[model samples]
Target: MSAIKVNQIRAKLRQLFEAHLDLSDIGPTDGERENKILSRCLAALAIYIQTGCTEKEAAESVWDGGDDNGIDAAYFDPSDLRVVLVQSKWINKGAGEPEAKDIGAFTKGVRDIIEQDNTGFRAGLHAKFSDIALRLSSPGTSVHLVLVSTGASVLAKHGTSVLTTLLKDLNGDDPEPIASSEAMGLAEVYSGLANDPLLSNVSVDATMLDWSYVATPFPAYFGVIDGLQLKTWWKTHGKALVASNIRHSLGSTEVNNEIKQTATSTPEKFWYFNNGITLVSNEALKAPVGAASRAAGVFSFRGASIVNGAQTVSSLAKVDDDNRLAEVRVPLRVILLKSAPAGFGDEVTRTNNLQNRVEPRDFVAQDPEQRRLRQEMAIEGVDYQFVRSEDSMATATSCELIEVTTALACAAGEPNLAVQLKTGIGRFFVDLSKPPYKAVFNAGVSGARAFNAVVVHREIERWIDKKKTSMTKKSGPAWGALVHGNRVLSAAVFAKYGSGNLSQAIASFGAAFDPAVIEAHCDIVHAKMAAGIEANYPGKFLAVLFKNPSMSKNVFDLACA
Candidate 1:
């Protein structure tokens, strides 16, 4: 009977993978019904489902199966630096469970990959060998093996024990287990397809209690709930809960670490210590919790997302392993946005997150002037990405967070200031609040001027890249010297275009960005940069150039040259 049930599941899985692989050219008859090629394609498709990667990217990440040594598809998620090893078992038969021997074979395959057994290393895997080896060597890196099976086999107790022992042995003397295994059964597959389609339909189901109706801010509810309940909710919804967040979890930061410490050790004080979570839902309903006054009850919210409190929610979820859920309760505020203003949710997320101890770049991104400019730029069909963090740069995002600040600083006649702030972003959080520095930012400067600054900065950097890439042996060291001179170049360009008036320069940016004119100014800018660097450091290390205010001041003075 169980075998019959598994066969039904296998058929459903076959349909799911086939549909997912349809976009790719991979066909069922690729291997003439041997199913090898189809199985490999299905493995990549399964990985896409788990990681939200596009079908093409997923296919490209697959390792050729001829010498795969058990793994079918592998992708290192750049967002979290997690290596996902996907094993596809496309069993046609109605097997009730995977054979114990088969389970051992999969574990051995993982062992071979970890040990880098050249005997089974295919050319495709070999190409990625260095990256995989480096990631394995890195501390705190996590490896997850997801077994995607058409067969309905739960790893039996003995199978789990064997696999655990094998994994433990492979990890050696590491203080913490670096490897974990998961089985993606039929239900998980179906849920992945149904709930998380490529174009998602946001829906949420939450258990809210001790809630009161608030009519002032549209129709709403104010409630208090245990932190454990929130974690339990996340187990089902996961990433979907915070779909509207500007960025995903950046993994543990100092603030998040403190959140976790408070959650686990001092859970009772969580409500007072934390600001709590904010959620926006399309629709909500109230149910009586006790001899209910209409004012107090449990509210059920749908199409909900945590606009604020992503860090709080993530920290609460982590405390579950230590069984600390019992001690924590947090305040909950839900806004009824069934007919809210346009862009309200984003505004809420941006407004709330800005108050936290975030990166300096993040503060720049939160500037209203920059936000308004970004919206205007989008209207003009230009992508001005203002705040992509380091890990988030896996995909191409033009106009990074630091670059925006650099452009602003240089445009405000402070090229050396831009250079000093470029690297070691954390080192200059204090500067974000201070003088001539703050003047370059959105709050202190007009959007048009800031936008013009970015344009000039990007153009200079683009020219720099073009020049460096075409450098010969004679110019290679020269290119290296000009590397930190980006700030100098930006200042020169701004000065050339802005004509000692940043706002006036912005008003006539079209003429400033002309390729021929920009090229003509490069020689003059380089000369200014060279003179400025020599005057500032003068036989000292490059670090001394930024350390001396006189150097940046000198570079600013050269903008008119």
Candidate 2:
């Protein structure tokens, strides 16, 4: 059977209630097919909700229905025991809204149904709203009612007075939530976590994945086939999925690349990447990257934030409206650990309560694991734990706190031992895992700096050990979306488990990635690369692949594209 509960039914009913003025025939389909649908829906909702998904995370939200004892289905919010109720009815195409008396009858029927269902399933329901007169006396019933329908909920145009009267009623309105740097909502929480590229698995076991149903920032991408068929499909079809020309946060400001004999005094060397840019004053002959930064003793990642003195502020969020964040510099020292439960947003939002953005500085840096038995491995009915793929991810987010602590320690270059701080979110709560890491781990970054120059790809492989691989599979930004991130971006991998696979996969493609495509990509590079490099095989590192600084795209072809 389905897991749909009375409240979920309530939420579904709520939508129908609001969509139309009446909701009698629109709900509880009497035909065998509709009845089976209702029954299966009820079972599926019940089973999945019990699977550990918060009501909202279960994607069980519906509110177009009315309040009163008429709740059809709904889910509850853990942070606050806010319950959503629903009243739903299936309608065929071209059907009109039910009559006020029918709505009144169903509305009346739901109250009785609640009493009957309540006696068995949720003991709380029987106690909460089984009796109409009792619930009406408790609140205005405005706070609890939801009506759902497949079509319109226009109970009014049909000249229905009762449900219309209910529609006119309210405990009044509350402020609509706004998501800023400070506050978040139920849906935002899951969406934000889903946006994270670092996440790998969410189920109790490692194999089950929580991938996106739609296109998201850190895409939950997968392949249904293998090899050339896959690669062919990927190149032909998948490329559309990948944004080909992202407005690079870093770009060349040069008006044109043209410079004739008259303009050439002595073309000087240039260096640029995600970071800022740099160019030698001389206009003579130019040189390669090895002749530039490595010689100058500087290496950096895609730029964080850099601005002209005129911009006037360091943290752009404070100075500019909208934060002017696209392309602003960010230090690798900064790490964000966001967590939230599932099932808050049945429609517009998600579980984990968009409230995932707790202050980074708020949590005390402690390994949640090391604390030992502060909390249990969840004690709810195990069957009630199944969650939507998106909502199911909260379990793994537990690693954030400790991982951030490790990243900060590495960044600070402080002793490897533990240090603590009282954070803004909760005072005594501590972190427990060590998925810790550092961004700018070496000295080369602080020395050489850039002002402005032609932007190019960052030499990330130079810093991280690009030759190694990882035993674990994961995903996220900076994470390979196809297979788990085995080929990470750097070599200085660090984890509590140690002997880290973190940096090993630097620039390494994913499991679904075809070596032929890689070889072809290399062929493109072979023509423009530093030269003398040919056959690529047997764990060839990205660092050695384009090792030469002299690589350049053909001018004519570059223009055509």
On residues 1-561, what C-alpha lDDT tens digit does candidate 2 reach at each position?
A: 112223334345233223322224345554454443442243223312222233233333322223333344544322112233444444333234434555565445333332222322244443433343233222112123433333343545543455444333221121111000111112222233233212222111001112111233311212111112112222222112111111111101111111111012221211011111111110112123443332221122121111111011111212222222222321111101121123211211122123333322233224233222112212210111111123332222122333323233322322121111100111112221222212221222110111000000112221222321331321111112111111111111211112222222212212222334333332232232212122222222222111111211121122112
Q: TM-score of every model?
A: 0.55, 0.22
User: What TM-score does structure 2 among the candidates reach?
Assistant: 0.22
Candidate with top TM-score is 1
Q: After superposition, how far is residue 224 of candidate 2 from its true place, in Å?
A: 39
Error of 2 at 228 (Å): 45
Model 1 poorest 10 in a row by lDDT: 472-481
lDDT of 1 by residue, 1-561 (tens): 545645554454445454433323445456544355445555775677766666666776666456666667778765344677877765555344456676776776666555434346666567675466546433334677877765564777876777787666645443334577777755555456556534324555555556677886677777777777778766667667777765444344445556778887887788898888888888886555553554345556877888788778876776745467756778888887877788876787788778746544555555566677666545544456666544543112235445566677766554555555532333333345664345555454655555556666666777777875665531221332355445656666666766344454343654545666666676677666666556554533232233235655665566456
Least well predicted 10-residue stretch by lDDT in candidate 2: 447-456
User: What would the TM-score be for candidate 1 when compared with the true structure?
Assistant: 0.55
